[model samples]
Target: MNNLLDSFSNFSYRNKNFIFLSFLILPLLWLGIVYLGSLLIFLGHSFFHLDGFTGQIVYEFSFKTLIELFSSPANIDILIRTVALAACVTIGSAIIGFPIAYYMAKFTSPKVKIFLFIAIMLPLWSSYLVRVYSWKLILAKEGIINWFFEKLNLEWLLDTILSTPVIGGPSLSISYIGMFLVFTYIWLPFMILPIQASLERVPNSLINASHDLGANKRQTFYKIILPLALPGIIAGSIFTFSLTLGDYIIPYIIGTSKFFIGQAVYTHQGTAGNIPLAAAFSLVPIVVMVVYIYIAKRMGAFNAL
Candidate 1:
């Protein structure tokens, strides 16, 4: 037994690749068999058809579900709405997070940086549902926001926002604007962390060199900082965009009757028992992320990570 153990240790020491593969084999199997296997099975359901009369799923493969997914006006609307919201959330996160990230990276001392990092990450330590529901209350018609507006005589401004077409509803909590706000808030940390990381990697010497060469602050930023940070921004966008695309809970709890892709999937699978339709809805975001990642890759976004 002792000889066998010695021989095994010697073999492991000699073939580091074997040690690496031994450690990796279980995780790779888990990923391949459990994760990818389940995903393939779920996606395969999209090819099958559901019977309307008997409420049974036909095991045979067909394009009927895919056709229905694209052809239906309502489904198309949901898809469009989801895509638009994701885009809006991504843009909003970028806009709001960049300044904070820039300040954290370039201006703050180590102690202040730690404080800011904690502030950014503190919300994530709470339950996701709790955070979302808290937003629901904060944005409600009779919430503190409304009271504050009334106190300041700015109720008209709030009313005007709530009265706007398409994006507006009877209350802020039930409006697209509110949903957008929540999405942006939830994903802002993701955006900030990446941009901050990228910006930290920017050499101070480069900035000094640019100044020495007679480049102004604006010129230096536009030419050097922004270009280098583009990858981080894109990486962050991937998180914010993909997350908004698939989030059902926020839309369901906070927004109007309009369906996003996630809500549609939940309804089709859970309530309606139309598994194929749900699977098809699931594929939309996957396809969208594939395209998005492809574009991000083309722009060298992975370099920042």
Candidate 2:
């Protein structure tokens, strides 16, 4: 036993590559075989068609499922809606999160920074469903929001917003507007942290140099700050965008009866028992994320991540 232990220790001491590979081998195998294998299997389903009359999946591989996915108007609408919502959520997150991130990164004292960090992350420490449900209550017609509007005599403004076409519904809790607000709130931390990280990496010397060169704040921000922060913004967008694309719960709970990609996937897979269609629908986000990542790579967003 001692000899075996000595030999093992000697082998590890002599071969760093072996030690490195020993640490990595299990995880690599798990990723390659388990995670990736499952994904490939799931995606394989997209090529198979369902026998509509018999209601069983026909395992013979073909493009019929994919064709049906794209050819259907309802399916197309769901795809478009999901993509649009993801884009809007990403943009909204960036707009709202950037200033807060900038403040945290550039202006806060260490103590204040810690406090703000805690505040930003606090929601994440709780149950996601709980936070979502809380928002549902908050956005409901009889919720505090409506009550506050009534107290302030801004009920007309509230009514005006709730009456707007496409986005409007009987109440904020059941509208796209509310869903947007919830998505932004849920994903805001993801946006803020990355931007703050990127901003933190920006040297104070650059800003000083810009000012030394007689550049105004506007010029410095536009030229120096914005460019440096672009990578972080893109990184955050990747998170917010991909998350919004895949999330079923938020849209299911908050939004109108109209379907998002995730909801479509869930409904097709379970209730409808249309696994092929569900698998095909699930691939939409994967394709979108692949494209998004490609674009982000061109813009050097991976550096920020």
The C-alpha RMSD of each candidate to the native structure, in angstroms, is: 1.6, 1.6
Each model's lDDT: 0.93, 0.94
Error of 2 at 103 (Å): 0.5
What TM-score against the true fold does each predicted structure earn?
Answer: 0.95, 0.95
> RMSD in Å for candidate 2, one decimal?
1.6
lDDT per residue for candidate 2 within 104-156, as digits (tens), equals 99998999999999998897577889989899789987899999999999999
Give the least accurate 10-residue stretch of model 2, judged by summed lDDT.
119-128
List model 1 lDDT by residue over 20-134, tens digit each. Answer: 9999999999999999999999889999989879999999989999999999999999999999999999999999999999999999999999999999989756678988988
Over the full model, what C-alpha lDDT does candidate 1 score relative to the true structure?
0.93
Model 2 collision count: 0
Model 1 root mean square deviation, Cα atoms: 1.6
For candidate 2, what is the lDDT?
Answer: 0.94
